[model samples]
Target: MRRRPQKPRPTGASQYRINHQIRIPQIRVIGPEGDQLGIMSPDEARDIAVEAGLDLVEVAPTAKPPVCRIMDYGKFRYEQSKKVSSARSARVEIKTLRMRPKTDTHDMETITRKARSFLEKGDKVRFVMRLRGREQAHISLWITKLNAMVETLNDIATVIQTPRIEGRMITATIEPNNSSSQSSSSSSSSAPSTTTSSSSS
Candidate 1:
């Protein structure tokens, strides 16, 4: 006979609404216009929301008495989308580069070139040095190599993670120098001075 597969457990957010034994608590209703309608029964709240051609969504379900709102679900979802988009637009991207401990000088130079490009593009880089065979016994060599790379890029990049061994690899991360922004701002400030001189004399 075949056995049935076990169902996966619900997440913390899902578990509450599923097994809640309390009464479908009455929700105080409020209109989208920010008007307070005071406390009302669930059925009455639903009726009021339907009359306004909107949804009766529970806003604060954990309050002593839950609160419901009469609002357009479509408009509410649009506002939420705007908030998430704005947050994502403010975040910077990160890039990664991988190398082995036995990597030669030419290859290291190529990798460093790529790392510099990433930093110039306002992206952070993760440098990974993978170890093999007896190389794992000489972890110090990996640290020394990473330090040299950091020194090469010190003017344009800042170390975010010091070299550390994890499993069979040593890893480090670096971000673009914050001074890049300051220098750009200073150059723009000088541009206005030049423009003012041209305008006056």
Candidate 2:
């Protein structure tokens, strides 16, 4: 018998596990403000949502006991739909930097500079390192290199998709770190600038 083709991973609005779709007996819950509300029965979580006049949504299904949050389902769906639509019209730029395994430090420096530029522009960066011959033998070493390179950009960027070995290529993606930028602005505004002066009697 031929193996049945796997169903395409669910995408878009239908992927959301909200309210009755969350069947787990117990799950971790979070309040609307992103605070942990601890673990509770699904029914209990639903009651909390009901009291709060919101919807209980399973945000992280794969986590231990899963994680559900009290949110406005209608708003969530609207935002999700808008994300798909806006993302298309956003004209987001993605630049892929191709390299070979065991890339030299000089080459890495160049790649880092390019990645930083793309991220600073609010563009995405995809790192693809092709392996040839025996270079593919030590995949771990290449992954370590990719991870290190990602860390160097962490202050300005955040990983959307972690590096992975796909056949002969290691691939990863990163986008501008908006939260970092916001935090930096806040920090600058709060910086101490007032100087104390002493007077002699």
Which candidate number would show the highest TM-score if scored against the true structure?
1
Superposed Cα deviation of residue 9, candidate 2 (Å): 52
Q: For candidate 2, list the clashing residue pairs, or say none.
A: none
Q: TM-score per candidate, in order?
A: 0.46, 0.45
In candidate 2, how many Å is residue 42 off? 69
Give a tens-digit lDDT track for model 1, residues 1-201.
222212224435533221122236566778779789888776776666666666566667788687767776556656866987755533555566778777788888888888898778666677877788999888997799888987899989988789998899888977789734544554444331101100000
**Model 2 C-alpha lDDT per residue in residues 135-175, reported as the tens digit of each score:** 88889999999899999998899887899988888889877
Candidate with best lDDT: 2
The runs of at least 3 residues in candidate 1 whose Cα sits more than 4 Å from the true structure, single-residue gaps closed, are 1-89, 179-201
Candidate 1 global Cα RMSD: 16.8
